[model samples]
Target: MNVLKRDMQLLKNSNDVVLARQKVRQWATELKFSLVDQTKLVTAASELARNALDHGKGGEMTMELLVNGSKSGLRLIFEDQGPGIADIQQALKDGFTTGNGMGLGLGGSKRLVNEFSIESEVGKGTKITVIRWK
Candidate 1:
């Protein structure tokens, strides 16, 4: 297989977050991902989308369909120009949050995906990428 498709969705507000989740689920299902895989990917997309809105102020998410030989996968990249994470290690720890809500977004999303990575600059922004293979 090869790269099937790529899409970009802006996460400027709450509604975009919801749409992002729906799009991720649709893409997962279109690729014939298992129910469990679809759920995991969708859940992770929601968390990241919300983080982009609440923490990053606003951002965009890019979804990609990847294929290699007989295997295929979904990749999502969330980026924001808001104040970047000050401490990435601390942020990745479960139960660590700067807001009122429970701090499960980053770590939990990572756990739900087959691959996870994050990068941030204090005054710049943050970028989180996650991928799930099928």
Candidate 2:
């Protein structure tokens, strides 16, 4: 999938998020992601996808699943071209969700993976990448 895709105005609801997550899980499993790590990757991808949908309004998301062929690790890249984030530090803080959730989305996702990175620009968009090792 090249980790890059575009969807039309999918932020209109939350159900889309569920579907997207499921798809990511299925794909990860097929890609040889360990059951345990698959869950983490899928969960993180889901949360971030929802974040992109919820926050970006509507934009394309790029995802990447990297395999070192030795189970060294896998990476997921998600990018959205919507409104950019201003305070990266504040957003990364625990319980910092701007939405109705507990704000643990980012924090929890961070704990699930070994490496996490997010970059955003005001009036631009946001990009999040998570890496997990086997």
Candidate 3:
């Protein structure tokens, strides 16, 4: 895979989450993604960004324009250095949440993208990567 472009943003507060969504939308638009695709990516970005800020205690988001074979895609990586998730499987299950949410962030974000992955250490942190191909 070749990364055509890359950018990073700090997820420090709610404003940063909005900014992250805007940035994702801009990138998706630049890639000529459809309106529905743009909305899906932006929504996923918002959920992951909020998770980074609220559950991970503020983190960073990296956006990448990727080219693999003849396909182009947008990739998002969210990382945070806070108490990590203990049970990834349970977390990925719908209606499972440690916070006071409707419990659809992680699972819903996964459905919005073409690829999704997550890594976490109990006492270290968590990292989530998602990709949407166009």
Q: Which candidate leads the pack in lDDT?
A: 3
The TM-scores, one per candidate, come to: 0.96, 0.77, 0.98
What TM-score would candidate 3 get against the native? 0.98
lDDT of 2 by residue, 1-134 (tens): 13223222243457766766776676667667778888888788778878888888754444455555555455666667778888988887898978899998888888889999988988889877777775
Question: Residue-wise lDDT of candidate 1 within 15-88, one digit each (tens)?
Answer: 99999999999999999999999999999999999999998999999999998888899999999998999999
lDDT of each: 0.94, 0.72, 0.97
Q: Which digits, one per residue and each the tens of the lDDT, describe model 3 over residues 38-99?
A: 99999999999999999999999999999999999999999999999999999999999999
Task: Please identify model 3 stretches exceeding 4 Å from their true place.
Answer: none
Worst 10 residues of 1 by lDDT: 1-10
- Candidate 2 similarity to native, TM-score: 0.77
Number of clashing residue pairs in every model? 0, 1, 0
lDDT at 134 for candidate 2?
59
Which run of 10 residues does model 2 get worst, by summed lDDT?
A: 1-10
Consecutive 10-residue window with the lowest summed lDDT within model 3: 13-22
Q: Which regions of candidate 2 fall more than 4 Å away from where they truly are? A: 1-15
Report the backbone clash tally of model 2: 1
